[model samples]
Target: MNNPYNVLCIGVNHVPVRRLSKLDYAEKDAKTVAKYFDTLKDKAHVTLLTGENATRTNVLNWVKQCSNIQGKLTVIIFFAGHGSAEKDENNKKLERCLWINSNLDTGPGSHQLKTSEILNLLNNPLHQLIFLIDACYNFDPKQEVSIQDIFKQFKESERMTGLKQYAIISASAVNQGALEDPQLGHGVLTYYFLQTMAGKYTFFLRRKISFFRFLAVLDKRVRNHRFLTDT
Candidate 1:
């Protein structure tokens, strides 16, 4: 089926590193999200990149190719994994990045992709872009600066570009962990997001819910339930 929109769902469940613990349900989260978009096969072209296939090279290549397509296109990227940021030599915050692979080193060969890189790659070719990040912002507790503050800084950098039609929904607030629910077998944010998308909440059943609306509902659900910290 031909769809006007393209969706890229990337999930990193297992990072092959001894220092990094495995996200057992991340693959499940990715698959579930991909399937949810697959249901909209008539309206969107969905692609799933997970596990070993979600390397930095592969993900960037896909973004570059998507940018070259000529049309009024809406591209959505959903990532569920570990999110990290490194301090510059002067102790300033660098860009928050997604760990696409198991490499924990902060180097060129680490297989990490920065949010800025994604934006730069997708610039000027798509009609709209959305980022759904289900990961922790500051995994290090000694950083002193809060994740919310870091996010604000990130947004300020983005605003300088003057791109207006994009939205970013991250799972947690400052210093809060993006938790997971073991009983539910999914990430806390991912579970609620899918639940809303599936119309499991009756109030949203008949409405064309916007991303902001979904996030509002999700925040409520998360606050009401007990979720385990992502360790």
Candidate 2:
């Protein structure tokens, strides 16, 4: 089969209306990341959409438009910021992830969109869809949240019928929060991802490395950082 003929990358830095607005930062960072994937544009169609101002509607539209893409299609979504999660009643085993937003209510029927929503959106016919979330999911200071738990939940969903082949890489573990380096001025996971792809840590992994290994190496590298914190 031919390689993927299209690519979509979405990145966000700030939650809409919540915390500090970092849409500008996310837009700038997305542009740089888009550059890294520019070589693919010549061989395959690529669409890079990003911003702190990016809403669930924007994401939904992107997913709707890309689902019908012919041939192999690679969809990448990168998120950077704070996130939270809670138990879901309808889906007892699954937890609902909440993206931080200014008007998000902590009570029942809050406004944050669920991960299932995003998953359902990309559950199309793409050859491959990669999800990279660089943010904290549980924000309760008294309690710790497990990033692994959330990831495991998603992993289990793949067993269901009709979902595309997927790979997920998070900035930290279930109980950990992504660290931001004052010196580097970016999330630790983002830094390591860039470094590995830039020939720093992957130098010894042979010339051609698979996406899984790249994420594994990057995960370990981020975990080993000195300023690790639980979010």
Candidate 3:
């Protein structure tokens, strides 16, 4: 309970709307990550938000509260649900968005949370925000905007004033889908992440594995995923 990390694990198995397809292991993926942290028993707090509890409002409110905790903190927003893209205002561009629980049938803003919106909410100096999105997007042409381009927009020169740090790690690349299988019972992204953390595989630069080094291992595993889905 005294650790400096504040982790929020969110996974949604189903969206209320009839249009969205039901998922088999999204919720389980969330609990799996949360359980890993729970077993570590070294975090300041591990808040697991699954099913309906991970709605837009609840998630936003919790993030809003993080700004008030005046101290050095690492706030990790680990999501294992769906990630898609929405058309921008000009209708010529698409932005990466994370969809939670929303009953609305309207466009992206109503039922989805854009990466830009998340940056705005967690724009605090005291806490470092880390985003882990395991959603499957960009397999289609309409939503072909890559996560790399989306995050690039936020590197505004103006944000250098007080922003601590914002790091985002996605499960898939530009044109791939975030993958999962019934056999693993967990998304490929989540599984490899756990493996990386557990030191299951050796790295060439194992002497002092940096964050980028860790990401390299995960990126390799996801790219060569052995299941039905490909990330």
Candidate 4:
């Protein structure tokens, strides 16, 4: 009953291919986010995978392992890496993938971990999954109902069944890009996210950082970023 959430922080900066550009702060950013979760009520456990360790195979395998865990679970998946909305030859649709560490960054889409693939693996009746995507080139993921509605149901019943909760917070809107700031020493999304979590604002001292408040401040600062084009 102690560990309420299983946090997976996946960051891949070292792409082993010429087709994709290397990143500067992805590994650092992933750790930063994982650190935040570690302090979340001391009930959220974290598993971090970065650089070579964050290969597509390993990450998928880790999630698969967690899916087999019994009882109610809140799974938080955070990714900071190179992502794109490119044309998939197989489906002929715009496929979204977060580029992980692998030798094959081209031809086969297996190394490029698809967003849908991750979702499919954790599609259980008793899981509350949150996707905090810090990669570039993303679209708003579709929602079934809303997180609020799910929370209401969860609160009303001690033993709810047959459905799960989902919420996604992307760094940018569709056709937009996210970046790491050289001066800030972190990705734009990560930099501000850490600042807000660090209680830079005067709000946290007065009240615990709830999701709504934290996100409100984060969204405001990100949209107001001078160099950032979209949010």
lDDT of 3 by residue, 1-231 (tens): 234777789999887555567888888989987877676455447889998788777787788777667778877778988776566767545566777886456564676777677678877777787678888655245555666655654443111122338777787544346777766778888888777877845321232476666767777776677443532
- Residue-level lDDT of model 2, residues 100-209, one tens digit each, is 33243455444466667777766666456666666655445433436565576654432112233876666644444556675555666667777777884452213467
In angstroms, the error of model 2 at 212 is: 2.7
Please write out the lDDT profile of model 1 over residues 1-231, one tens digit for every residue: 135768888999777644557887777888898887777577778888899888887788778877887778878788898776645435466556777773345554275677878888888544578777777665455556665657766654331122486667666533345666788898877888788777744222234756556657766776666433422
* TM-score of candidate 2 relative to the true fold: 0.70
- Model 2: how large is the Cα RMSD against the reference? 5.9
Query: Model 4's lDDT to the true fold?
Result: 0.70
Sort the candidates on TM-score, descending order: 1, 3, 4, 2
lDDT of each: 0.69, 0.56, 0.69, 0.70
Write model 4 residue lDDT over 2-79, tens digit each, in one string. 267888998888776566678898899999888777776567778899988887777888789778888888887888
Off by over 4 Å in 3: 1-3, 90-92, 103-109, 139-164, 200-208, 226-231
**Total clashing pairs in model 1:** 0
Clashing pairs in 1: none
Task: Kindly give the stretch of ten consecutive residues in candidate 1 with the minimal lDDT sum.
Answer: 154-163
RMSD of each predicted structure: 4.8, 5.9, 5.6, 8.6
Q: Which parts of model 2 are misplaced by more than 4 Å?
A: 1-6, 16-28, 92-111, 139-164, 200-207, 226-231
**Per-candidate TM-score against the hidden true structure:** 0.79, 0.70, 0.78, 0.76
Question: Mind sharing the TM-score for model 4?
Answer: 0.76
